[model samples]
Target: MMKYLRYALLAVAFLLCVTVALANRAPVTLALWPDTVTAFLGFGYAVTLPLFAIVGGAVGLGLVFGLVWEWLREHAQRAEAAKMRRELEQMRRAHPETAARGATQPPRDKVLAILDEADGSS
Candidate 1:
């Protein structure tokens, strides 16, 4: 059900994008700087692109930037999680009794516990 819904949403978005692209078929000039600025700087660039292409490119760049920003921001959390995991492994190794206790504990889920019991009795 979730997969179907995702596909439906994707199809709708694709149709909308196609409609927008068809409606905006004209070429648009994209400039790195204004004419006056270019004249003063002696260097500038411009390119003719479809309106939809320009819009899509901007959106794609924004998504890439956002992903990079988030990955950088979460670096500390990822490091902390790795540190804690290593600490847990060290503790498990250091305390044989605690590790045995954990291994002896029954499955927490009711269905798995019942299955274990059934297997033990068989």
Candidate 2:
């Protein structure tokens, strides 16, 4: 499942690169810089490229945002795991008997421990 998602994302990236190349190759000028004319030199006009620069810029920005989001997610998960570990340790320290009994036996022996205690008392 994970591998398939990765392959899909890679395919999308490849397609995006292809699209950018094709769009840039469409033989349209995105920006025109004019020189040697005093009034025209300083003035600039916005013209259309073969495809909108907005599209290419959006794709690039999306990829960056996705990578950053994934990194932050994994970091947050790791921090949460460490916090839970610390809490468990503090809890064990506060309950000496529970900690000792838990250490001496496997977790599956919980019911057996209760039964043994009952039998001993009776």
Worst 10 residues of 2 by lDDT: 29-38
Q: Which residue pairs does candidate 1 place in steric collision? A: none
Off by over 4 Å in 2: 1-20, 27-56, 66-82, 94-122
- Model 2: per-residue lDDT, tens digit, 13-96? 989878767766554444545543535667766566555455666678999999999998799789999999999999998998
User: Per model, how many backbone clashes are there?
Assistant: 0, 0
Steric clash count of candidate 1? 0
List residue ranges in candidate 1 displaced over 4 A. Answer: 107-122
In the order shown, the candidates' Cα RMSDs to the true structure are: 7.9, 9.6
What are the per-residue Cα lDDT tens digits for candidate 1 across 2-79? 999999999999999999999998999999999999999999999999999999999999999999999999999999
lDDT winner among the candidates? 1
